[model samples]
Target: MKCPLCGCEKAHKHGKTSKGGQRYLCPHCKKTFTDTFDTIYYRRHLNTDEVHSILQSHTEGSSLRGISRITQRAYGTVVSLVRAASQKAQIVHNAKVQKIKTKEVIGNEMWSFVEKNKKPVSQKN
Candidate 1:
């Protein structure tokens, strides 16, 4: 497998992670990494399905406590999962969407901010 960090093509299976994921050793970087490395699931004990379920529930607008109850995970774990997922999504977005050509772009929140900050106009008698 090609090492993501060093782009080395001569990596080999070094070992298995505690969660039974295959580990690879990068000959060039002299580092060990797993399939989940550089992903939201990296260094996390949760399996692929568990992380998927958490993200699915989060996308469904489930509250943190609700997700914790639904996934049978701790409240903190739910929060961390959402946080990690968002960070990974941001990284993927930045990588994939390199350029955008647009004349003008505005968001709903920006309009609200402008409306809220508008100066008051005095009434004419």
Candidate 2:
């Protein structure tokens, strides 16, 4: 694996993270990083399935509080995950939408006009 810090190709197996993920050490920069480095799952305590479940529930119209309650996670954790997911989605959307080519577009607009008839009634004295 390439070193994330110095972009060096000489990286060795440093150790394993607490979660059993492989860790690498870059001899060029003397930096140690895990396999999850620079990834969405980096430094996250929750496992992959839990993170997926949280994101899925958020997309499925579940509120943060609701997801927290259902997942038994802290409210702060749910909020943080939701924010991170939103940012990542925005990044992906920007990247993918920039490559789109548009030709012709069809659209419709509706206009309504309301008129009230005004008639003066003769008053009986």
Best by TM-score: 1
TM-score of model 1 (CA atoms)? 0.74
Q: Which ten residues in a row have the lowest lDDT in candidate 1?
A: 108-117
Per-residue lDDT tens digits of candidate 2, residues 1-125? Answer: 89988999999998888778899999999999998786667888889999999888877778777889999999878877777766676688788867557798675432211134479898999
Clash pairs for candidate 1? none
Q: Model 2: clashing residue pairs?
A: none
What local lDDT score does residue 70 receive in model 2, on the 0 to 100 scale?
96
Can you tell me which runs of candidate 2 are displaced by over 4 Å? 104-125
After TM-score superposition, what is the CA distance of residue 17 in candidate 1 from its true location, in Å?
Answer: 2.6
Could you tally the backbone clashes for each prediction? 0, 0
Q: Where's the lowest-lDDT run of ten residues in candidate 2?
A: 108-117
